[model samples]
Target: MSDKSKTQDEDLPYYDHPTGGWGSVKSLAKIIARSRPDPGIMQTLWRQNKPGGHMCTSCAWAKPDKPHTFEFCENGAKATAWDLTSHRCTPDFFAEHSVEALKSWSAHDLEMAGRLTHPMRYDADSDHYIETTWEEAFEGIAAELKQLDPKSVVFYTSGRAALETSYLWALFARLYGHNNLPDSSNMCHETTSVGLKKVIGSPVGTCKLEDFNECDMIMFFGQNTGSNSPRFLHTLQAAARRGCHIVTFNPVRERGLIGFANPQSPMQMLTSSRTKISEHYLQVKPGGDIAVLAGLCKRVLELEEEKNGGVLDKAFIEEHTTGFEAFAQSMQQTSWADIEQASGLKRTDLEIIAGMYANAKKTIGIYGMGLTQHVHGFVNLAMYVNLLLMKGHIGRFGAGISPVRGHSNVQGQRTVGISEKPELVPLDKLAEMFDFEPPRDEGRTTVEVVRGVLDGSVKAFLSLGGNFARAIPDQGQADPAWKDLTLNVQIATKLNRSHLLVGRKTWLLPCLVRSEEDMQATGPQAVSMEDSLSNIYGSVGKRKPAGEHVKSEMAIVAGLAKATLKPNPKVKWDDWLGDYSLVRDLIEETYPDDFKDFNARMFEPGGFYRGNPARERQWKTESGKAEFTAPKVLTALGELPGEGQYTMITLRSNDQFNTTVYGYTDRLRGLEGSRYIVLINPKEMADAGLSEGQMVTLESAVDDGVERRVADLKVTAYDLPDGCVATYYPEANPLVPLEYHDQESKTPAYKGVPVRIVA
Candidate 1:
């Protein structure tokens, strides 16, 4: 091999700088050109971050405390511009391209094709989507539902769903006599929801935006804050300035965690001054989070023994915790050798970090998919909670747990009754409020929905804004199962791959983007949203509609409810559609304690924060206390794939959000030109006798009778952890086995999957 090529193989390109620099500005400009050409677009775009205006159509990271003129990050701008793009995908566009022809288009190509302007249905003979009237579309769906058992229909919602729409979406399904309400939550934060409820008494975070100003230390476990939530860099930068010790534990040295240059500040932008983040970083192995935390706990316990419980909060633990004795006993049994090997860290490294944790009285723990998308995701989360619990750090100002959610409304969707298994017990109140009998049985989850489709129990699939087929695990299984469905319908603003993954029949109903104006029977209407911190607020779109045919998400849901539940007159669907305040009134009546005068509170400046009970040290758990869970270590990682195998982590490009691809380049990661590439450790490449530009086929170790292989991926040597390789997901999603998921939460294990590379 040539010397230059060898060096290139040893490293993927590096920026040697912090994230959120000039590169973000360039990205924002390019996305604007694709979305629209109107000069007034800029004026409308600026309103996205204004208080009393629409929330950013991207990540739900900000606290919504004080309103800023320029509140949006670069990614947020990209999302809004992409949504408000002037390009139109009218009936003519669909008629020109066949389903087979459209399949060849890349993700970017599909998005650039423009926004869908009307409702459409797949014609069996033509193999093309044909335009239909809204009445005809709703009637067709009602006819399909009339033939099947109510249990046979699966209703799914994406995180982009608004709070107002979500409440209506759930009521419609229950009024239809079933609760088959599966949502995106089941695949992502179900572990955080289930695990945290056991420990902290609340599924949401224990702290609010104001807490960032108080914490002495911030521990980022597995999440990449820079790329995922660029706006959060401001918070980290400010905290760093205040002498907060920022520690990061991840397999990759994410640039965002390293440092950040705030684009908003004129001085920082002109001077090119960057703020350093992550005072301490631990390169923990994939699936090694629990081990690393356990090692820290062991050292803390050892100190407590030496100082006679001086290291732990005896007063807090005695009054507010349960099962500490069992949890502590388990920590003592974990050997240092096992911790070192599993975590890929030295005992001294663990001790040093533990000492820092012990010294900090007020700390915040934040994590993302790295800890959630695993077989032991629930316990993976519980371990961090365990450490914080021992310190009595939770349920206090500046100290709590934060699971940074992916979607803007993923948490809000669940909050407003879009859950498969409804969070509130005794559905009688909800039933009484809506004047209908609610289903008692728990509904199917996102994972269970797929199983239901495969087994023929689910004959129909209806979604509100998500690329369900591409986002879900096991395309090898899910794609075919979808084809077997009696009907598939999607309510969306843009065309996605899920709309193309057809069942016996498919339909696409165009809807309004949050950036576009929504005018109902009333003059103008606004939708409310809840941010990642559970801050509720009203957001009204200032721009004109992308297309006149496109309706608001709430309007669509109300129309569907009116047509389907014609049998029930108790629901004043027409009135709810005319005045959204009526819908909010019902929410207050149903969840009186949580949503007292919900309609009136929405008009407040910067909206409102629905406070967490756990923040006040209230434990709603079965024990009426913050319960401690014993960590369960993985006994055996599946066998290695012969001689050339490695663990695989499915990743998102810096240019992408979830399954939405804004561009082909992962600018933050220094990759360009292509998406079908894999990053491997230099030592792993040497041992496997592989070099750069070499082609390899990746296959999952655990197959479900169907052959799962992603072929001809270009390999490059990266500085990833030993024996671990990484690739962008949706491309690598084919390699994720269908049944390989967490036992408790059923979230697919996207990280640390055993795989073999075919040379």
Candidate 2:
């Protein structure tokens, strides 16, 4: 590590100070300095928050027609302010700096310079990036792509890309004979889709925001609602006020879950009167979620047998589900002693939760990456469904499952077909809609793509938005693998860490921001997004374009497609680029039943809701019922590190999103301006003969060889369960091996890793 890296590590303590005002001021300064946008420009952009403009790109929960006076959140303001930055990367700037020099700069510093003004090409001999014309850049990319095998090319999509852009990219990849779509979904919620599909026959949740108000009891498992999804705080507050019982189960006592002041409410904000959130909080050990869920279900089953003539939904199970007998037998086989030990919760606690469930007429379960980023993440989701099935929570007005997605358009991308292994039906339908036979072979996922690049199977990487290298685990392996790629193209509005990990030939193409107006040959364009509730809504940008030269993502994809693909009389790339509604029309044709009147419905204020099978208690399985799947118990359950070692979980701070670091401040943890401190129980600290704020190193107990040791980290005593510790993500992601992912979902096991603490 360099002196700068060492200094940053050493400054962790200062960042963790609990002084709120100073921290907020420091964060504001950081945001302004790092974004490097003119204050005047940002003020002008901020004024564009009119009635007809779309909601901020960071969060999709904003209500339309609401006054712009209270429209933005802290993160949303930062995102928009950053977009309005006046900095620009001219050809002279690139010519002055070598790729090696730029690579040395921090991720934030590179992006602070502003957006790419024109197309650029990497010069290998000079190790610098020089400006190039759009025609030359397209021609070079097309010539190289035509020589390589279609399978060798990887098309990566980020969450920031608009729906129209995503569809065009998918269309181009399919028309060019490739299905290699390694997207943002692969890193986040692939587990939710994979697990839900097997049991509910749909990859989406059935619950809407309205369901939160109607539920009698709400159980939040393995999710940090306050930090991961702040908008959920409003729902939680409303439910609490309505006398609904709310329970939170996680390793950390998240502040947002405890209570929150509605920033939008003038009275609440001015008076500082906060609404209490959780009635009960259970801090369970990391990776112990499966045991906790199973225990609750077991207790519910026992209660059902005693009072409700067996707690199982006999009618629903028999009529719509399969494999009940096997699943019940497995539950019967699980001993209470094992469950108590693994979950670190008493038997009475389980009964209390179960009693609440049994008495409630309806309940809604909400989860985030915490539950899905585990080794048995898919199984964890299945267990959640199993609990719902036992009580017949599906097909009801107030009861269902909701998985809070991270990005605005992530679900939209999946809806428009950005999958590595797209189903045959969709491929066949696309072939009929576009007059081209889509590739039937399976493509590479995120991890698989990295591995392919390492082994020389993949040649190119075309990313639409995210910083993949930083977001993915196993950076030690990925950094070298990234250098081996033949071409790396990023279509983004700003710079990020992934841009530094350049390939043999790299290109950075500037694109319009989501909040910016997208004008093409056709006219003004409108994009669509699918929310967590499976509701598809139209988003129209009313703000002017950030830069005159910047193009919408759709136009960029179209240009690339026209340049690379073999000439086909049937496909009209230019026509689709001219009008995005035509792309929606094609999407409607491909998925006729779901997207009828694609253009007409989108004109409605809130857009349309997609089909959800669980809402009607309809299971699309072969047996016309939901299926019960019992996971096999691994023999490694009882095993632990020799001594003085416990499981470690990675989490996000209240001030930051995935890789986009707005600032280093975690107000909920009482840690301000810091991203590198470990939270440990005071008892655990004393048991290890350590004091608060003692420097310690964490060593991975797993044999995956991924290790991260931070010296002199402030050990703030927290109310976490025994044998469990917590730290922030990306910083702690290095401790998780790429192979330590859920088998069924292929999502990284970020929440659970065995580790030892040392001085």
Candidate 3:
């Protein structure tokens, strides 16, 4: 390996701050230098984050009404500068380097190489990618797809695409007679959509930024808000200053949950003083979230019995809910002993939390992957809603459940048909508009798609963005399946590992990023993006294109649709690609209730809210009320480490977002210069006869008979729950088994993985 690639903890220095501070500014400078952008690039950044301009392609945390001089965050700068980077991966670059040579580099090193500049086709004979014309690439994919069964074709989307592109993606898939759709959301928060739909009759969240301003209590369970969504720090800091009590539960005591030094405020930076965030931090063990929540629900019921005055919302429960008695009985039968053993927390700890929730008039609950990436992920979500329903936390401001969504527009992708199972209501609307019978079969998810590929049931695969080979679980199985596909195609901005893993015939279509201008027949056009809060607005690129050959994602999608699907007068691909307004008109017809006058609403200052009716106490269930479904079991963590085993949960480093690794330094956790590492409890390390900084291998404890091991990962002692360990995801993804998933949502159990340290 090269000297730069041989990273260890010995040479690099680590820094710690209360979330955002001067450290972020210094880190931002380092990223800009790495991008090697022109001095005039500042002008592009200045105009890129405006209302009518392209939205910041980083985190989906909603921007404030009152914009700052520099509106973007530290990570946002990295994402934009990454696109504006002068480094280009032309055809010559690929020709000079073999596929095997690139495989030796780290994910961060590969991404830092630069943006792709032209369409390319993989040549198996030479083991290198060669330049190809757009027509040749399109025809190659069309011929192969037309020869295969439409059911064998799988379509996947990342959270990065604009609404214009996503709308066309859904339309084209139905026109081509297939519904095997899967997106990034299936990996992240499918539980929130599925679980919330069962409980509240809606898959969307009810709380807004205004809720944090008015809520008496904010319970942050399993969320590292400061690191994942830094823009949320502004609202969190404001609430802390206004005397709102914050409670947090997680395996790690994240610095963001403890305190904050607002980098956005010059005064806060000058003082170098930090403001405390969570008043109480409960360190719950991994896979033990359900027990803690269940214990709290039982305590609330006890408090209601003793107080007898106004503990439970009796009127609201009677008027707007069902199945309460059944839920209450389940909570009662769940003993404190079982709760303590399962949750790894004492009854007193849960009682303290229960009392806090009971006293608060208004409460907002927020959670993340800690709860969603478990085998009982769906039940974990239901338990939270059950607790909230006991106190009537929904259908009002300052009180509701928020699953803390991860990508910039992941929720938006689902809002506009990037789904495997499109709702019947939307299907009827699409059938009426296009004069085509929508596919009635239940679609496939990410896991299902991978299984199809492995069994030879699936023949072709197409991706808009995201590196599926690295992002999904069971790399040992998924990677080879991708290589053996009949055809593989990717429409992407940068070169990822997935692009290098070629099938019989693979094509990489270069597309313009959010920072580059999208010129079309209808002149300069602006696309739309939806935030986690369901706010939709226009985003137009400001700067010149990095490559003359690169096309917009919308154009690429339309072109592929025209090439594959036979001509139909109702489906006008060229018109939609040329004028994006025509696409918005189609979306308006698809969801009239939500996107009414979408073309006219695009002109709104920051876009429309696309409000959720559940927020207004209108639960459109079979009974026209919120129905509670209690889990039969209180906790899903059956047992702790067996002999020399540990329950592992995959995590993201501070310097990265999703699968994109910007650097090896994770400032929040105080590690640097390596992604191949594991964090273990010091006590557990001593018991396992392991020492800090020891190079070791991890073998899965699951007896699937598939030897899944991650070797050469250095061990580091950390302050985590005993018998529990953590490692950065996409690196440890191989250790996760495809069979280990939430039964209800099919989300892989990334947090509940069972493994043993190998000598």
What lDDT score belongs to each candidate, Candidate 1 first?
Answer: 0.82, 0.74, 0.83
Point to the candidate with the largest lDDT.
3
User: Candidate 2, after superposition: displacement of residue 758 in Å?
Assistant: 4.9
In model 1, which runs have C-alpha deviations exceeding 4 angstroms?
1-11, 423-426, 634-643
Rank the candidate models, highest TM-score first.
Answer: 1, 3, 2
Q: How many clashes in each structure?
A: 1, 2, 0
Ranking by lDDT: 3, 1, 2
- Poorest lDDT segment (10 consecutive residues) of candidate 3: 1-10
- What C-alpha lDDT, on a 0 to 100 scale, does residue 458 get in candidate 3? 83
- Candidate 1 clashes between residue pairs 3 or more apart in a chain or in different chains: 35-85
Local accuracy of candidate 3 as per-residue lDDT tens digits, 385-441 = 888988899987789988777777888888888888866338887888888898878
TM-score of each: 0.97, 0.91, 0.96
Candidate 2 residues lying further than 4 Å off, grouped into runs, are: 1-52, 59-72, 308-312, 634-644, 689-697, 704-717
lDDT of 1 by residue, 655-720 (tens): 888888988767777777677888887777888889987998888877457678889899977768
RMSD of 1: 2.8
